[model samples]
Target: MESEYKHLQIGVRAAQAPKERRVLHRVWKYKLMYLLLLPACIWVFIFDYLPVYGISVAFMDYNFIKGMSGSEWAGLKYFQALFESDMFLTAFKNTLIINMYKMVSGFACPILLALALNEIRVKWFKKTLQTAVYLPRFVSWVVYGGIITLLLSPETGLINKAIEWFGGHPAYLLAEPGYFRFILVVTDAMKEMGWAAIIYIAAIAGLNPEVYEAAVVDGATRFQRILHVTLPGISGTIVVMFILRVGYIMSAGLDQIINLYNPMVLSVGDILDTYIYRVGIEQFNVSLAAAADAIKGIIGLAMVLITNQVAKRINDSGIF
Candidate 1:
């Protein structure tokens, strides 16, 4: 039995030796590339994976002084609290509605912008127009939000002044709950559309020029060429972007909402991120906040997985 075991070990080692040598050879050959990647791997570990350990706080009655080790095990207590809380429910609903609105408008706007830009024959005019649209994305949301507030101001806004000139009542649009989500969706699209169009434009540029020429030779109109050649060429990028957008459905533009929203519009504009900030940072209810955040993460992850599968099935391509 001992002799047979020794023979088996020897055979296994003999088989593994060549594989191990090949791995070592490849590593040595790519040493420079590996070295370049080391910093990125370290950064990901530190910033992304290291925080994963703290997710346990969601299941614990986390105490600052008591620390993680001394905290009481609360199991699903916090998660239950999250579901039961009226504020959380409102935030959850608002998050979904707002993100859906943004997704529907935001997704189409960039594609349309890219297509429109692609059709422009005048280079200088296209560049100037692109710059005008892209400039909004560079502005900080704080400054942008302040600008929005000023524009919507009832007494002194340019919009109000224009309305007054037209013999209309100058209304405070920001304070109205009905208008808050619409403003968020429109502003978000305006800010992001040009920037997001860059990828689609690049994708369009990468399409085969011969295919477009063939379409033109076949008597296809400009719109028909775009439909057949351009759209199909960039469909993969579109699918990947759509999947990523769906993954963040739970996020709902925290920065934009935080800067734009007030007490009056909170009921309509409040999202999970803002709710978590209020509970965790301001109120210091750590466990409950953690649980709510955990739910967001889980939902986002699930959405990504499901969307990736659906995208693959539909388009035969995905981020994966």
Candidate 2:
């Protein structure tokens, strides 16, 4: 029996030898690419994975000086507080409402823009239009928000000026709670739609030209071809993008909100991220802030899993 076991072990080792060699050879062949990837790997480890250890702070009464190891365990105290706090609840509600609108509009706008751009036959005109739309994405929210603020200014904004010229009263759009969510959705689309369309455009470009030609030969109109051919061809890309977007449901564009929102609109504009910032960083409620953030992360992960499953069930497609 011992002799047979030893032989089995040896046989397994022999079987693995060539596979191991092939892996090593492939790594050596792609050494340069791996070298380039090293920095990104390190950065992700340092900034992303490393912070995971701090999640423990949420379950403890975190102290700046005492730190995680020395802090007393508080269990679910902060999480309980999150639900009990009116401010946190309000923030959570606003987050959901704003994100829902943004999600729907954001998802559809890019596809529409990509389709529009794809239909342009004139190469120079198409390129110019693409470049013009894509330019806003390169600008930081700080700058873009400032531009939007100027445009919406009650007194001097271009928009208000146009409204005044049209015999309408100029109002402070940003400060109005009713108008705040609309502004966020519109601005988000304007800033991101073009950049987001690039992926869709690429996906559309990769579709079999022959399939499109067949559709044309079948006497399909331009719209009909797009509906039957272009959309189905890019469905996989759409599913992947949708899954990714769903995963980040808790994160509602912090930079844009921070730059654009004011005290007046906090009731309608404050999100989980801003709440965490205020509670954790501003108020120095470390444990409570950590709890909120941890919950946010957990919900985001759950969302990704749920959305992926739904996508798979609907059409046999998902990120996994």
Candidate 3:
């Protein structure tokens, strides 16, 4: 019996050795590829992973003179204060409202634009339209904001001039709270719609040409083909992108807001990022800022997980 058991153990070890050797052989074959990836791994480690340690500042007094190691621990003191502050609540509310508006307007615009562009038979016309829309994405928000300011200027702006030509009163669009949110949503969509459509267009391009041919054979009209074939084919990509967008529900375009917003619109336009900058950088309250950031990160992470799970449940397509 002992001899039989010993022989079985030897056989198992012998079988495993070949599998181990194959894994090592494959690794050796791809050694150069792995070497190419080394720099990116190091970069992520230094820039992404290393900075995570600074999250500890949320629980500490975080004095610049004392340093991180020597800083006094406060144990959620800043977090408690943040929760009770009116500014934080206002910023949170504004962030959610603006981001939700952006999600609705900005998210659907790209997909619709891509579908429209795909139907264009004239290559030159299509290319020209794409270029015109995409050009705004490359323009810095600072320059674009200045142009928008000039265009929306009540006195000498083109839009106001046009309004006057049409016998309508010229109003200060940016200063009015009612129009501020709408401007943010529309302007953001316009700036990003073309760039966002590029991904969907690529996804559409990858669809099997035979599928559309079959749809045509089935007597599907152009719109029917788009509805039945193109949309379904790219639904997975749309879902993935939607999940990512959901994760950023807390981030309300700080650069654009900061540039376009003024004291009048701050009540409606102040978001978490801008609020964090004001409190942390301007006021020198490092701990409170860190706490706010930590909360945002945690909420964003939770949103990604929840949305991914929902996507998987619906269609079995998720980022995970």
Candidate 4:
């Protein structure tokens, strides 16, 4: 009986040994790919990892001349000061509200756009429309700024002129605190919707045509087909994208916000990124800014992890 047990153990060990061997061999097989990835990996290590050292300054009474070591430690004092500031509160409020709008509007806009494009029967017209929509995405927001300004300009913007032509008053869309954030959300969706649509389009395109053909044979209407077949096929993509967005909850679109924001609209438009620019660049509170950043990073990471875990539990398409 002892000999039989020993034999069974030897067989189990032999069975496990090849998995280890196979893993090592697979690693060796992809050695060149790993070599190719070295630059990007090193770049992340240097830029992303190395800069984390500066997070320490958030706890310090940092000064330029004193340098890192000589700077006095303040523990949680800066954070307490930040939490007490009205501007900080305003910044947090604006950031969350604006980003929530961006996330929902931006996320849904693309999927619907992609679905609409998929439904188009005419190839040439569809292609032209697709090109027109995507063209704005390639253009820099600097150029987009001029375009948007022309459209939203209080005096002569095409939209305002149309309003006047209809005997309505021109709304100074960007200037009003009530309208500014709404405009930001709408414009952000417009600018990036087509670009975001590209991924879903690709996902839809990769789907088996036979499934649609099968749906057609069963007399599934376009809406029904989309609801039943097309959507389920891309649910994983949707979940993954949703998870990814949840990961970046702290980032309000900095470029768009920076380009569009001005002194008149700071109350409605100031976000975490722009706040950092004000604190770090304008006021030279680099260490406090760094601390703010570290806090944002930690919160963002926590959100991602929580979101991913929840997604994994429900749908199993997770970033984990």
Candidate 5:
């Protein structure tokens, strides 16, 4: 029994020693880094993690006066109501359609833009072009939407004026449901394409020059080198970004859509976030909004997991 106890102690100590060393090494050697990260840690805890408790409001008949603890537990009533509502179903469908459209088109545009920009040999021109394209991204959606409204106006807008000059009829683009989704997708792609391309450009920049030299020696043309070397080099970055994008498949662009859309286009433009805002803030149905939020979170979590698994299977790279 004594010998057995001795052996057990030795094994336990051996297992714990490495863990202790790791903890101590992190504290001792990387204390400055940890200090630098402290503010971000606090901010995340306060803003992100702390608000997670509010998720419980989804299961309760939340009342501002009663507060969280005093609110009556209503179980899944709000969730049931949400799933049964025709308006919510419409919003959910619209959200998925719009998000998928944006995902497919928006995802490809940045990569193409990055490749085109990468081909520019003139440094000053490339920098100027990059700056010019990226400026739109920094513009607030409200301001950009106003600009778009003016540009697409049937009477005084440049587009309609051009159409009239060409003997075509003028059209109110934003007011038409058929044209709204197209406008949303195209405008969003234009706004963010430059900012999105920066990541791919950085990935392309990190590729070794030796690979290009070797390809040149093998008589590869510029396009051939880009297709073979540049793309493959940045495949990992693309995969990672794509996986992250998939995680947000449920979230249609709320800010842009809210600013640009009107009652005429609400049939196609009313998305989950906008619906949540209407129910929660406008109608004062707090529990219903919480339930909608909970559902979105669950779907997003599942998407991330499934997408990561798919990415791992296909390319052996994933966010996980």
Candidate 6:
């Protein structure tokens, strides 16, 4: 019994020592880095988190005059109203559908584009393609919206003119429910695909040339070398990006939808953000808007946690 107690005491001390050492070491080694990051950290705190306390408006009969603290507490009335309303349901569905489409197309297209771009041997051509593809990412949605609208207009638009040339009747592609989603997907894909590929391409570049050389020595073809060596090397980036994409499953492209959507196409194109904008800001119902924002925020957080947990279950690389 005395020996057992001694062993237990030693084990307890050993377990506690590492944690104590960790705290001390972090202070000693990473203190400078932490200090360097302090300004950016404070900026995030000021802008991102300081405003979160105002989320209480979601639970209250918010009045602009009363502000957050003075707002009348109405429990779950605002949230209940959101769930019960048909308009909310339609908006929620549209949000999820468009976001899911964005998630899949946005995710897959970039990976494929990155892989294809990585294969090009011509230095100048590859650089030009990369620049051209990624250039749209920097362009504002407002500018791209005008471009898309002008090009897709039913009357005398480039697409309609092409349709006429082919002896097919010109159609308002953006007006039709079926084609609106496709246009959104394609245009969004086009705008962001090159930019998205940047990270993957960077990852692919980091792979050791020796691996490729070894494969070639073993009589491996270029395709086989890429399939086995290049792909596995960059999969961690893929996994990380995929997890992030899943985390934002509730967020469709608001700017794209706002600029592109018309009343005729609202049934298919209207999303939660747009709905919230119309009901909260335009209609001046602050509490209801706050409630909608709260629900989306909670769901998005849940998605990130679930996705991170899944990634950790498969491998150690996860946001958590």
Off by over 4 Å in 5: 1-17
Q: Per-prediction TM-score, please? A: 0.91, 0.92, 0.91, 0.90, 0.93, 0.90
Point out where model 1 deviates above 4 Å: 1-30
Which has the better lDDT: candidate 3, or candidate 5?
A: 3
Q: lDDT for model 6, on a 0 to 1 scale?
A: 0.89
Span of 10 residues, lowest total lDDT, candidate 5 = 13-22
Question: Highest TM-score: which candidate?
Answer: 5
Off by over 4 Å in 2: 1-22
> Which lDDT tens digits does candidate 5 get at residues 1-320?
99999999988886778887868866989999999999999999999899889899999999999999999999999999988999999999999999999998889999999999999999999999999989999999999999999999999999899999999999998999998999999999999999999999999999999999999999999999989999999999999999889888889988899899899999999999999999999999999999999899999989989989998999998987
Superposition TM-score, candidate 3 onto the true structure: 0.91
lDDT of 2 by residue, 140-183 (tens): 99999999999999999999999999999999999999999999
Query: Which ranges in model 6 have alpha carbons more than 4 Å from their true place?
Result: 1-32
Query: What is the C-alpha local distance difference test score of each model?
Result: 0.94, 0.94, 0.95, 0.89, 0.94, 0.89
Candidate that beats the other on lDDT, 4 or 5, i.e. the better one: 5
Q: Please, what are the lDDT tens digits per residue for candidate 1 over residues 272-312?
A: 99999999999999988889989999999999999999988
Give the 10-residue window scoring lowest on summed lDDT in candidate 4. Answer: 13-22
Clashes of each: 0, 0, 0, 0, 0, 0
Cα lDDT of model 3 by residue, 189-297, tens digit: 9999999999999999999999999999999999999999999999999999999999999999988999999999989999999999999999999999999999999
Q: Per-residue lDDT of 218-259 in model 4, one digit per residue for the tens?
A: 999999999999999999999999988887788888888888
Per-candidate alpha-carbon RMSD to the true structure: 6.8, 5.6, 5.4, 4.6, 5.6, 5.5
Compute the lDDT of residue 167 as modeled in candidate 6: 96
How many pairs in model 5 have backbone atoms within 3 A of each other, for residues 3 or more apart or on separate chains, i.e. clashes? 0
